[model samples]
Target: MVVIAKQNVVDILLMEAFYEMHQVRDRLNFFQEKYQQTFENFSVFMKKENENFEYFDDYMEWKAYTKLFDEVLKKIEELKNGNFQIALTALR
Candidate 1:
């Protein structure tokens, strides 16, 4: 397992979710699907979870806030829908 520095992880939360968002978007685009709506929904959920915690909360706390300690259903939902272009754009 790789250990991400606490600070770097925070930066990701603030910005790097693009990678994850792209991962989800790419998977959706692959199947030629119709779930762009799903990504919006999951993004909403992720926002809510993050809202519960501080933006720069400690690593463990931020993970918990993001529900990373839980099922991470939002990420799954986004990935399942497939909209790689959106995900990629988010990264940039």
Candidate 2:
């Protein structure tokens, strides 16, 4: 049996959150490079042009990544600010 302190748990959560954020950012960067523009700009361009199936598919994926990136950033911020009780509670 092993005992883990609360601060240790928080530190682990912060590390995991940072890792997730990095992954999400990488995905966002891939989309940005593929489109040669930010998601918002690509979205606007898509709206102004005839809908191409490939672009549409990429758009959906890019949108999802964009949202996930934001969510991950928020999680990292919360963990950094010591608002990780919810995470610890859920682990119980």
Candidate 3:
């Protein structure tokens, strides 16, 4: 049998949360790059078609993803500050 203390459990959970946040950070960077590349390609296509690329400035897909990415970043910060307990409670 294995034994673990309450503090140890909290520490372990914190470590896992930190790892998850790191992964989220990586995903955020990846998506940002992907979106930039796609947008650039789209702009090139619009220019070829003689369309105004400025209309994409208010693109809904881009806006929604940007908001979601920001939220993920904020969640990472909250997890870093040890608010996982509160978060877990909220989940329950």
Candidate 4:
């Protein structure tokens, strides 16, 4: 039998999420450059692609992956905050 801490699991998840996020980010940048269109904001890019849904499936998939990355990041932040609070309380 083996024991693993919850934080270890969260850390693993965070690592995976970061890797996936970067991959998607690179794809987004590649597509933007390929199309010769750049936007500082993801939402703006999404809006621009909305009109070309029939031809921009890859862009749309990247957008979905971006949203998933955001969700994972939010979970990581929550987990870190919870860990911090636990540490502070233990010290006190």
Q: Quick one: best TM-score, which candidate?
A: 2
> What are the runs in model 1 whose C-alpha is more than 4 Å off?
1-9, 33-92
**Model 1 over residues 1-92: C-alpha lDDT tens digits?**
46656555445453545555565445545322432344335455556675544323333333343444123445444434542232223333
Q: What tens-digit string does per-residue lDDT give for candidate 4 at 1-92?
A: 46678788767766876787678678767766666764335446666665676446756665676677677677667766654332223333
The residue-by-residue lDDT of candidate 3 on 36-79, one tens digit each, is 65544544654565434544553445555556656766765665
Q: Each candidate's lDDT (Cα)? A: 0.44, 0.84, 0.56, 0.64
Worst 10 residues of 1 by lDDT: 83-92
Query: 1-92, model 2: which lDDT tens digit per residue?
Result: 57788788778888887888788888889989988999989989999878589999889898998888888888878877877664334344
TM-score of each: 0.25, 0.83, 0.39, 0.53
Candidate 4 residues lying further than 4 Å off, grouped into runs, are: 39-59, 83-92
Query: Scored by Cα lDDT, where does model 1 land?
Result: 0.44
The best-first sequence of candidates by lDDT reads: 2, 4, 3, 1
Give the clashing pairs for model 3: none
The superposed Cα distance between candidate 3 and the true structure at residue 21, in angstroms, equals 0.7
